[model samples]
Target: METLTNDKATLEVQLSTQQKLIANMREELGICKEHKAMAESQSESRGAHLLELKAQLEDAVLSLEAAERRMHDGELMRRRLHNTIQELKGNIRVFCRVRPMSSLEQVGADPDIQPALDFPPSDDLLSAGIILSAPSRDGAATLSKHVFAFDRVFTPEASQDAVFEEISELVQSALDGHKVCIFAYGQTGSGKTFTMLGSEEQPGMIPRSMRQIFESSQGLRQQGWELSLQASMLEIYNEEYKDLLSSKKLSGSNKSTKEGFGSQQPSGEIKKHQVVHNPDGSTTVSELTVVDITQASQVDLLLAQAMEKRSVGCTALNEQSSRSHMVFTLRLEGVNEAKGKRVSGVLNLIDLAGSERVKDSGAAGLRMKEAQAINTSLSALGDVIVALGNKQPHIPFRNSKLTYLLQPCLGGDAKTLMFVNVAPNIQFAGESLCSLRFAAKVNACEINHRKKG
Candidate 1:
């Protein structure tokens, strides 16, 4: 009986101890669950913060990209503005172009006779400064060399595309509301025509310029500009303006008409229109044909028609030679809706008659008269260029009709470029030198811009 009671007491003590241990284990489990919940809550908070930070970082990157683009655009705008200002200052640029030797000129040449012309070394392989060789009177083999510098020079090897690249910026200036004049001054058969009006395979300045203007207009439409272009073609023969796009003229390569003897009248009773210099410093002729040009093809057609009407006569130098100066003018007028401003720009592309000596040209009769007129006008032009270079108080703009009409171009607000073409034939060295000297004088003339509207 005593042993059974002791065993029951021991069992009771063991049960109490086991209960205490169970209570302690439950408390510890509760604390661990609480800590786990708190840890999960903190992890959720950190995940949300990371998402916010990621979004902020992405926004910052986008902002940086936008800023970079804006900065780039600003830089471009700055360059454009700088160019516009330079052009507005009436900086007359000059470029010289040398035609390659023709097969005819190279048919029979002295093997011992060296080339009279040399070009200086230049960074641009396409262009080089001109160096002319003059034979000394002593008859020594050593030739006198004359070197001339120009704004740019194009060798015979230069492509039309390459030549256009140098002047494309000038075309852009015309679109930017500045008057731009580009004329070729050279002897006959010096590739002036080829450079100005290249063939279908290789278009020259007029075609290239027209194409660029039209294309640029399309792009500028986005900038709130509505542009309208008008064109007119005319010939200055015997100091008279003959409408090239006139309906009265027939289309042929060689047509000679005896012009009437008068200051402005030719053989035909073509109306002698009076050229009025506008108060705004622009030239306008009475009874002139101005055609609206909408597309590049229209320009092509107008040019073709003008060429057909141009007075060309066969000469010893050139079979299809320009007897009269042909001037093709483009007037660009635009309205900028954003700025509420009106912009007017004039682009004059001139192909002057070849400056040839009457004796060398083998001209007689009407051809002689034409040659005399060409020489007279060109002399007057040279005089005008000289006066401009000297900054003479009195420029003889009224000395000849050619000078009168080109007053705006010669020494005024117009941005003018004279392309002096030279034939590489050693036989024509004298005439080529004359042309270069004239170009050098013209290059030295500084023109100032008038206030633009």
Candidate 2:
């Protein structure tokens, strides 16, 4: 009976335990439903937040692009403004010097030239000799009251510094890739040559200018200046252009060959009728002296050779008409070692043949022809200068060989300077006035400066 009671109690305990477990399971199911709902709500919030973040990122990207665009535009505008300022710069610089007069026979002489001081060397180079020293111990006295006294006394060896300063600035422009020009003017026997090309022993502007460039280049080597140089020389004779330094052909070339007229396209460019082409497909150009000179001595050699081959003949008005215009050009093709790009600049040293009176020259035949050509070309040059000064619509650069050759100086990107040589002689009064007027006009011309290869 006792065993039956114990078994009944055990069955009751098992049934209570099962009922507690069912209760606990029901509460857990309700809690799970609440958790699921909260999870759905959080997901929706997260999706909205994600969309906002994407929008912000897109706005940031757009802002960055806009900033870059603005930066590029500002750079472009700044470049334009800088170029405009350079364009407004004027080119004309005129300096007048009344020359001191001394008989060519009285002053220090031309070293490389001799025999006849007034005449150029005949096939015999020494036949024409130069005056060695001042005849009078008081050289200044001979120079003071002489007709050219104003030029000689007022103008000194130091005067070229001013000119070099101007040209030096031009060179800086060229180093930045600008073109430049320098021209000298005076009446026949007025010392234009002296100002442009000093004595052989004491070379003038051209040589000195070249030296300055070389020295400056060396100093600026660290700044990245790489230079390439070329030189060309030509003359306007009898309305005909001649290459004074071109090697003569012993077999086929003759006087006609030297006399042949053709326009020179110096270097390759978009040259039109302004520069004529050679029919031979070759020019006096092929005969050019192309040398790379690192040392100043190398340049000296070239100047010496050029002087010997120079077309110098004696005339009544002056010893040498410069029979040909000698243009000693320095083409500096520099690559900024710093910039890693190329730049080009040119220095033109022009010693123009002074205007002369045929009556004064007492020339004949070929000489007469040279005189007429010189006079005619000079007249045309004067007319062109007047037109340029007036800013007239038409500038007759092609009117004369001299003027035409100078198109680059007057019409192109160049810093131009003209030296007006005057004489103390009362006979030269008219010449002085004309030269001054021409200088004033040249100073007025506005040239277009543009960078080209």
Candidate 3:
């Protein structure tokens, strides 16, 4: 009986051990279920965050596109408004500039020589009018005052930057698809060339204008503007048009002839060029050299080349006087492929020959002939301006090569600005008066409204 009781106790111990193992397994299964639920919740949260990020990215992309579109529209509006402002100022304008006397001129100057030119004290009048006091021809001590007004006037103290500020708007017009003409007019030694083709230390209108165009074009690239410029330079010498950029070398005799004011006959034959007026109101010269201007520096190169080849001669009034009217034409062709728009414009920068009289210039023989030709062309230009100012039915554009070539700028839908450069010296008082009067006439003349092409 004792052996049977011991066996029953061992059986009971084995049963208790198996029940403890079952309880441990159930606890492990419950913990695994809780971990699975937490994992599922984390996955859902991660997916929601991803979707939110995607939506934000999409919103940012849409905003960028909208801003770009607005930028493009704003650029277009800017062009139109800028052009409108220019028109309101005037389609035709004139600015008078008086250059200071040279050091050589100041030496041994007469103490009795009083100041001939005076500026008004008022800021408004200072830029618009100049007073000239000259001694009467009767040899009296009395002074005759002549008051003249113009669109703008620059005194001797004005900087080149200051002068260009007033005309920068006109240069912008050329880029906006309007024909622009800016020319310097004055007698010899009166700073016309200095104003137009200033020294490297002090760049003039042509270089400054080119730099402005380049800078502006680069800025407009973001708005989808692509502008290409073509430049051509020519000179009208003694009623004859000569391409200043011609590759043909001028014969030694030809050079001598020009130096002596045509005292010797030219052995080399000069190519004849014809100016053709297109049905579209564009003027082109036959066989003219047209160079593609990719950079503003190219213009400087061209100016240097032209100056070397241009017709210059010695005269009594001024040595190395420009004996020809130099015309530099920059043709701008721009397109915005994105907007499906295109434009064509031209900028004509002319440096007219000095308008001094033959007697004053002390020219004889062939030189006299050259002076007469220059005077005739200038007279023709004056006549054309007078006709335009009167709004006549017929303008005499064909009266001279200079007038005919500038027909579009003077009479067509173009913006024209004349710089009447003058000398601030008692000796040049008469010439200064004449230039101011002529500039006044030009400022009064009006042309057709500008239409963008």
For lDDT, the strongest prediction is 3
lDDT of each: 0.77, 0.56, 0.80
| Candidate 3 global lDDT | 0.80
> Which candidate wins on TM-score?
3
* Per-residue alpha-carbon lDDT of candidate 2 for residues 312-385, written as tens digits (9 for 90 to 100): 66887676666656666666666754345676665667777776666766778887877677667767866876
Query: Which model, 2 or 3, shows the larger TM-score?
Result: 3
Q: Where does the lowest 10-residue lDDT sum fall in candidate 1?
A: 253-262
For candidate 2, the lDDT comes to: 0.56
**lDDT tens digits by residue: candidate 1, 270-339:** 4565676767766767656667788998988888989988999987777887999988888888887645
Question: RMSD to native for every prediction?
Answer: 11.2, 14.6, 7.2
* Ten-residue stretch with the least lDDT total in model 3: 254-263
Alpha carbon RMSD to native, model 2:
14.6
Going through the candidates in the order shown, the clash numbers are 5, 25, 0
Clashes of 3: 0
Q: Point out where model 2 deviates above 4 Å.
A: 1-89, 103-159, 250-287, 389-393, 446-453
For each candidate in turn, the TM-score is 0.74, 0.59, 0.83
